[model samples]
Target: MLINPTIEQHDEKRRDKMSQVSLTKGYWFFFEHEGNDISMFGSVWNGKENVSFNNEIVSSFRNLNKFKSEHSFSKNGHNYKVCTHMTNMLRGTLVVSLYCDDELLQTETLSQIGKDKPSKRFFSKTFLWFLVFGFAVGMLAGYFNLFG
Candidate 1:
């Protein structure tokens, strides 16, 4: 099975930091069945390095073949909804939706990676070069205005 999962940050402050660092803030796991991705819904960090999965989800995956339903779980004040739908009798897909308080944060589609993949790093080399060029241009403009 091929699994592709995406994450969306909710908090403004944390989002800003993630944009600058591109580091994984939490851990996630999913099960693949016949090339279909079945993502677990209720795993969260307990302020430690290890992630904690809800007991219900664990049991459901144990009997995954018989599991055909939707589940909801809450962690760190965030609510999540997860479900799987069969495209055919033999293959299906899973969807995980996340919300903060009452506002929708992000919805991840777990599937195979695409050709236009995003850079893992937050800041690219080209972005750094652009920053340097902008700084140089600003300094030159200020000098011309003040001393020319």
Candidate 2:
């Protein structure tokens, strides 16, 4: 869905619990645009979708990737929105940020955080530690002649 480009939701029902996540993961912005001026911002990003409006989609070249897009529209008023999305494909976690003239308007992060790299990092670290500990134990046993 083309969510709001900014945080000012005309309806309260549209508000989300992202006042905190936005600080670390995402941001939104809104601004006024007028006549022939190259607006600084207003964007959107959709990774799964190919047809993005008023912007481009950029990939991070990794499964743990980010998507970026942006554009603006206005003849004499604030009439545009832009957003970016960083999503972890392995786990369904999403981070989206929107902007206008460098001003933040709204941000949203999927509450269901995706799986972190715990599996890879955890297993690797544990295995390495185990190997080190085993080596030390074997050396001690050898010195004490306990394994003979």
Candidate 3:
């Protein structure tokens, strides 16, 4: 299986940084099957997903609302499918699999936990808390004004 360096090694600290940078552009998966070069790109923020063979795009679509999506194409009289599954919401983890003729060939996973700072996460939680608090207070004030 042809694998990109960024997608192969997941435990190392340096690879974590590389993954963060790649997220800005999107997640890229490279594979080789039966003498064919296949590449897949999945966006993290948006819902865009694409598949290419020999540098030519074969299938592309946007997936929103659903946690799992699949892309299918045929080469050499065989059907090939690429599936992306979101496994973890908190960690932002996704599992991608490649299948040939309904048989699984390879699998890869991408996560956004690497290089994530605690401060950034804390601020996000704090912001969410304030948003909820403000909403509750607004509701209470409106209720009192109408009742009084």
Candidate 4:
């Protein structure tokens, strides 16, 4: 007797939860291509990227401080490429694209904007300090007649 396994379908809500995690630990991307399970992991902190086909890692590499990185691999005479890009720095948005045989198959984006509150407050506070410091410096310069 043989048992058949069912494939699990991913929804948009799961993707949203994954995006929030991407900014901290790393990113996990899952896709299905021609009945093949394709998964990828990328770490922004360590600059490591890995691509897996059917639970087997096909390509792995490290690229640091890059706005965009691309990894390519071939399996069973077919070529595959995974491209990761930092679309927005402020929002910490990461866009991952998968291609097979030079054709785009799927694209996913991970973003941590309003989801992370501490970092958001930090930016606002920093900007306020910058404005206050600039105003103080300008007043000091005027009082000393430094413009002349």
Question: Which candidate number maximizes lDDT?
Answer: 4
What lDDT score is found at residue 124 in candidate 4? 74
Predicted candidate 3 versus true structure: per-residue lDDT over 12-86, tens digit per residue: 343233223133566766667987766677776677877876656778889878889899989789899989898
Q: How accurate is candidate 2 locally (lDDT)?
A: 0.38
For model 4, name the residue pairs that clash: none
How many angstroms is residue 137 displaced in model 4 relative to the true structure, after the best TM-score fit?
Answer: 33
Over 1-148, each residue of candidate 1 has an lDDT whose tens digit, in order, gives 2222233323334222321111233323343223323244321112121112322222232223432344555644555444433223212222344333455544544321223334433235436767998999989989888556
User: Which residue runs of candidate 2 sit more than 4 Å off their true CA positions?
Assistant: 1-66, 111-148
User: How well is each residue in 32-99 modelled by candidate 4, as lDDT tens digits?
Assistant: 78877777777756778777776577777887878898889898788999898988978767889999
Q: Which is superior by lDDT, 1 or 4?
A: 4
Model 3: residue 54 alpha-carbon error in angstroms: 1.1
Report lDDT (CA) for all predictions. Answer: 0.36, 0.38, 0.71, 0.72
- Which of 1 and 2 is ahead in lDDT? 2
- The parts of candidate 3 lying over 4 Å away from their true place are 1-21, 115-148
> What RMSD does each model have against the real structure?
17.6, 14.9, 8.9, 11.5
Residue 47 in candidate 3 has what lDDT?
Answer: 77
Would you list the clashing residue pairs of candidate 1? Answer: 1-35, 4-110, 4-111
Candidate 2's error at 108, in angstroms?
1.8
Instruction: Please report, as a residue range, the 10-residue window in candidate 2 with the lowest summed lDDT.
Output: 35-44
- After TM-score superposition, what is the CA distance of residue 15 in candidate 4 from its true location, in Å? 8.7
Which prediction has more favorable lDDT, 2 or 4?
4
Which parts of model 4 have CA positions greater than 4 angstroms off? 1-20, 114-148
TM-score, cand. 4: 0.62
